[model samples]
Target: MNIDLEDELAAGMREHTADLKPSADLLDRAARRNRRRTAAMASGTGVFALAAVVAVAMTALGGTPAAPPVEPGAPPAPELLTVAMVQERAVAALAADDVQHIVSTVDYRGKTEHGEWWFDQVTGDSRITRLQAPGGAVTMDLWQLVRDDKLTMTQVFHDDRSYLVLERPLDGQRPPGPAGSTPDELRAALQRGEGYTLVGPEDLAGRAVLHLRFDFADGSDELWVDAETYRAVRRETVKHTPDGDARNRLEFEWQPRDDGSLKPLAVKVPDGYTQRQVPPVDGPM
Candidate 1:
């Protein structure tokens, strides 16, 4: 076409399209290049004029520029539980709460002893005063016979003259408290992360709790902690045996240091008592 004719045609095009606003996508692209967004296309009039020329040329060619390669923002990945994160969370939760060593519950096997029991964290000394023993309603004092630094893992009571004691192998390295004696002990134990698996969140009794599992060769032990405070709530240990599966369930309660939970550190054993060896209910060595 002749130069004068082309100039005249461009002038006519500008007049017809001058009032038109730039396309939303084109304005967005221009704004990005300028390092700041311009909500109103008119704010960048010079850039808009050039964009208008490109749009008119494309329209005449009967084709359009491909939409800016829109990259969709990827959704955030969900947090995983069976990883180190859970270990840190579980450890932190227990550390924030400060309570006594432990107040224990009864065994859940051959015989049931329903009462409250606790342990001494600093001394490794524990005592359980039961309102009722294996027999019926009567006061009973449960003690573990510890001689020197070794424990025979026997359950001995001081209330009755005749007592049944199930003796297990001596473990010199074992501490004084029962297996699930204290959350403080567990807080330290869980630092390894391999000792237990955070089974995930769960509902226990009527409140929310997190279930942590520790696997054994013959069985497994599961611990539940309060969902909010992350304190110890309950523990269940299952043993697979030739006879059957022996299960022991215990619920924990924590008290302040000066709550009279432990008044006298030393427990007095009865002077005379007959001891017998037999299988035990929910026994732990």
Candidate 2:
């Protein structure tokens, strides 16, 4: 595992679990489900190989050939897709603008894990697009455009002051801020063909994936891709910050529905956390 990949994975773990605070009813159900899954993963049955490429490609079919390589550090030259192309597909997939369910968990001190997210998307010209957490404390404030998506944070029943700006738009691009937006940007960054080395293909939990190592000034990232589909499946990032060494890991499993929409059916959140629905916007505001 490379540094970048480790750091990213850790970050994903933290980000995914940062806020729990759910109701007892929701918490009980979530904890029961997560414990079962976590046990499955920790069972260590050598099932990681089943998750690499085969599982990802079996979700949806694509029309592209093999990708050169898009890991962190090695050769900077590779045949990759452009940002525009990636976004085009994502946008088309999200055109209907249905709800976005975010199933996640959080880890406190690297111990127990518990969490889940279900977001209902609201589209159209409302500059104030909101991702209502169906039973939690966080809501995503998305600045939406037809061609770009930017993220910010908002508390359910509080003032806008709690808002935190996430990623901004790219130069000259005012795209819609849908669920597919940022992933599309990340895809573009990967396709730019400039910042990684190829490590060859490998297997993940019941899937076949391509492995790439990335290098940075102070650290690095290890990326896992679905070999057949050319989409990222997991990333681990490692960085040496001023405070200390930080590691983040992120794993994503997406299944494209017949409607062309991608859905995340499960996510493993670290321990000591709860996920709940955000209050409705029409309530008391």
Candidate 3:
């Protein structure tokens, strides 16, 4: 019975993996990378296990918990970066917006290991109050948990389901965009060209956090992260569009995620509009 269940589960995962669209896989790769960045900026260590736990909990619970337990080795409470040194750096960086410890997001349109140069949207939310596009225009709607640093997007609807979200995991690091540009992708993006800039750390909203900025010729991105858990306290973006600058700011407050993957929290939508989950694609991963 156990063997059969395992087989079924594995088969399901495989089918999901196989049916995933390239874009969703790219987003998933970016999410993993951002989480790692959050971990690094906060803890100075890569703790995939914690992320896995949070992921499972979030997926199962359908909403992020208000508070999550702190493992002994985990970064201290009131700070999410997970490291003392990183916490200090975040505090210092908070004094100024430019530098701080962090995990941030960016959109890239350049060369990569895949030999495919295309436009990719990347999001790295950490301990900050808001995120804006480079031109201060175009705010992306994402899945986030304000109580804990559980921020990610399972699905994104751009103008009534025009664009969909998908995700996947790979054996090695990936590069920017088209199904693989994530933190793992960063390893390769760095190899392809000069990667993002590491500014330093900072204090945001009375909390010490890290900050990192990535600028491309097209536009720029910023990240504010929690020093203890490496979770996003706030993220902002300024987008450069031919029309004008569009801005978006996402704020998070410390909460518990004892339930699961921080999602399905209250969504702030415009009046007379509604939020709904984009149905799973007909096929597998």
Best by TM-score: 1
TM-score of each: 0.47, 0.36, 0.28
- The order by descending TM-score is 1, 2, 3
On lDDT, the candidate that comes out on top is 1
State residue 5's C-alpha deviation in candidate 2, in Å.
Answer: 27
Cα distance off (Å), candidate 1, residue 50: 52
Rate residue 263 of model 1 by lDDT: 59
Q: Write the candidate numbers in order of decreasing lDDT.
A: 1, 2, 3
- lDDT, model 3: 0.38
Candidate 1 per-residue lDDT, tens place, 1-285, comes to: 123323543454454477553343542353234322322444333233233334444454334444444334422222223424445666676543333433344444465555555565544556656656433454665555455665433344545565654344455554546665465656665675467755555556656666778887998878777655566777777888776677766677765555475653344545576766665558565
Question: In model 1, which runs have C-alpha deviations exceeding 4 angstroms?
Answer: 1-83, 93-110, 113-115, 130-139, 143-175, 183-195, 215-217, 263-285
Candidate 2 lDDT, 1-285, residue by residue in tens: 223333433343444356532222322232233334434455332222222221222122222323333335322222333323333443354334343333333223443232233332332221322223324443343332222444333222222323322333345544343232235444554655455555544658867666767687897877666645555566666677676656655555443333333222122222433334444455332
- Candidate models: Cα lDDT each: 0.53, 0.40, 0.38
Model 2 residue runs over 4 Å out of place are: 1-181, 257-285
Select the stronger candidate by lDDT from 2 and 3: 2
Error of 2 at 165 (Å): 16
User: How badly does each model clash, as a count of residue pairs?
Assistant: 1, 71, 84
Poorest stretch of ten by lDDT in candidate 2: 52-61
